[model samples]
Target: MKKVIEKKVYNTETATLIAEYWNGLGEDDFMYCEEYLYRTRKGSYFLRGSGGPLTKYSESNENQTWGISTIIPISKEEAYEWLEANDKTEAIEEYFSNDIDEA
Candidate 1:
């Protein structure tokens, strides 16, 4: 599990991250990529993902960078489908469980 450090970049600054999947283990620094689920303050859902050479410059003589990224608006149902397909089990149980949290 190589550590993933997420930042509030130009695109996701207005939303709250709900869950993420980072495929970084054993990947070269310049080849890591990931996906994330997010929700807006108003309850809208979206997905943001990045792939390819996200860290192309980290080992080079230049500033670092994240890979190409994309944001897609999705329905709540779609969000759940995506999460399940990606095996985000913890996130599903935590965020969409029928049993309510007492907190």
Candidate 2:
């Protein structure tokens, strides 16, 4: 199934932070797409919101980074709808919540 990703991200710096964090750790388990940033762990994964076409970077002499030309063109409402339809928020919450038995 086509992954439904959120439109609203926590901050504009999130993408950069993620890229930098991954770079710092020297990992290559993430893929940047027009919809969302996909990170895989043990063959499973999750998506996070980020600038789509506008979230790329050019080749730089200082550090190697992704070149996000644009972000996923969407709004907050659309993002929420996608989340609800995919039931991702619930799954994520259930996974992270302290009250695992309650859920």
Candidate 3:
């Protein structure tokens, strides 16, 4: 995997708060910063953030700020393996045993 480092500039007010948050992070303090592919009911795919097994799906669309329709956790190793196996597919979307409720 290629590592790309991009710098983002936040406004002075936001920068202060962000810097504080960054400084507060200890070695063990980490969030699930991995991006995983999710396939919607329409068969369209999109990348969304994964917060591992404990992450909850928002009850309302209005509360879903992450642009994630669902929370399905896939590990980096598994994602890489799928990419290797399928020449045309870069990422793999898993289907649940039970149909997901849209309500």
TM-score, per-candidate, Cα-based: 0.58, 0.24, 0.21
lDDT of each: 0.67, 0.35, 0.30
Candidate 3 segments whose C-alpha is farther than 4 A from its true place: 1-32, 50-82, 85-103
Note the clash tally of each candidate: 1, 15, 0
Model 1, global lDDT:
0.67
Candidate 2 TM-score over all chains jointly? 0.24
lDDT of 3 by residue, 1-103 (tens): 1111233221222211100011232333233233334333433333333332223322335543331223233344543443445432312232321322344
| RMSD to native, candidate 3 | 17.9
- lDDT tens digits by residue: candidate 2, 1-103: 2332464333333222111112221122234332343323222233343322223422335555444333333443444444455555563353334433453
- Give one digit per residue, the lDDT tens place, for model 1 in 26-69: 34556676778987777767777666654421232366544566
Clashing pairs in 1: 54-67
Instruction: State the displacement of the C-alpha of residue 21, model 2, in Å, after optimal TM-score superposition.
Output: 21
Candidate 2 lDDT (Cα, whole model)?
Answer: 0.35
Query: How many Å off is the CA of 2 in candidate 3?
Result: 29
